[model samples]
Target: MSLEIRKIVSFEEETLIEGYKKADRPLRMFAVAAVVTNPWAGRFVHDLKPVVREYGPQLGELLTQRICELAGGAENIEAFGKAAVVGLNGEVEHASALIHTLHFGNFYREAVEAKSFLSFTNTRGPANAPISVPMMDKNDGGKRSHYLTLQFNIGDAPAADEIVVVLGGATGGRPHHRIGDRYQELQELGHDVDNPAAV
Candidate 1:
């Protein structure tokens, strides 16, 4: 099924610090959102896979490209994530149907060559509802410093029978990450940190 996109929204944020001191470079985050009609709203569909499969790749490409552009370029994006919010007339599953599949997610992953799966959220909400997208290191999901969340809201969207789909990107991790890396934590524990199954 083809998605009927009503409008698009974009958000950007720059964080400079966690405490008193600020870093030389600010951490930049960007998000791209699409407001679209929900094809299966107000009813239950026994099968959702086909619907998702049909539209996933297109949505992934479109959203990813937009966010990458907003952030300067895909190569500059260090972390990534996605989210969806369904309107009151639609169920949460309607949000899930558009985002949870690799058919859509893998496109973004491959575009950025991200190793970790895209972090995500799916829920039901009304216009002006807050939307949060949690991002992880594009190459190393275990990097705690790279974990971040970008939040925003559309002033007018998801007006029942609609869904808001978002894709987020970051140019860097937290500016002043002094907590140390995950590998260092594993090392201090004196465990087989290199073994994938041992942890």
Candidate 2:
């Protein structure tokens, strides 16, 4: 079955000053979402394979392209993530199915030339629900400074039988990041920097 898309929304913001100080460089974050009709809503589907397979690539490619364009290009996106919010009538598993697959995530990963796995969140909510896509350094997950969350909401979306799929990106980390990275914290804690599990 073809995915029935209702509307597409884009969110963009640039932070020039933060924490009462001017940023070294303006930080920008972008996200794009698609509200689509849920094919399996209000029903129990033992196997979601067909739906997932059919929708993943299309949603991934569509959302990834929009988000990249919002960021000016994949090169400008240093941190990235994905999220999905299923309507109240649908199961959270539906949200997870669409975004957690390789078909969906590989597009963004390849586009950004990222080494790290795409961060994600999947949940169930109603229209105007808060959508938060948590991101991390495209190449370095341990880089705490690049940890970010792009937040937005569609005034009318994800109706009882709909799902909102999203992709997000950030140009840089928090403008006033001083806490250093995960590796540094490990070293300070006397843990092996190379092997975090070793004391």
Candidate 3:
């Protein structure tokens, strides 16, 4: 499939803490989302649940790698935070299936264990998911597309200080922006880049 990635969406440092507070967790957490396009999503015009189920682990691995890179590696993630996978538009069902699959669930557990991060939580939003839609169609041709957003919280990693990594993208294709690049942009916007002490 010819996948196209649009952009990676992340929460600002100030907002990261806000999200952690919203989670009612004692430790700080960073929330990040990845928006990507599934080039084959609309082409098939059928439920892609099977493909998602089979590839969920791969997708999770990619997400974990991206998060690690953004956090400066596994050591930078706090030991008590949550991560989420949010989907939009045509991705609702497929994204949900991916996270709910057996292999994908195991991958998440392994990631947390290996990284020494706190707990991991997986969630999904449908066509009108709560999180902002990070990708848009330039053509606006009513051509339905699938987008995946990955969000995570950085609890108390020294390297994270006050930074949370947010990355998201459309699946089936490369993203318009890299997670690291987006983080830098957020920093330039004067987002609270200092790591906050655990709540």
lDDT values for all models: 0.88, 0.93, 0.37
TM-scores for all predictions: 0.92, 0.97, 0.40
| Number of the top-ranking candidate, with TM-score as the measure | 2
- Tens digits of per-residue lDDT for model 1 on 77-182? 9999999999999999889889998888988888888888889999899999999999999988779888999999998888888999999999988887777777
What is the C-alpha lDDT profile of model 2 across 146-186, one tens digit per residue? Answer: 99998999988889999999999999999999888989889
lDDT of 3 by residue, 138-167 (tens): 222122221222333322211111111122
Task: Give the distance in Å from residue 189's predicted Cα in candidate 2 to where it truly belongs.
Answer: 2.4
Ranking by TM-score: 2, 1, 3
Residue pairs in clash, model 2: none
Task: Mark the 10 consecutive residues where model 3 has the least summed lDDT.
Answer: 156-165
Most accurate candidate by lDDT: 2
Off by over 4 Å in 2: none
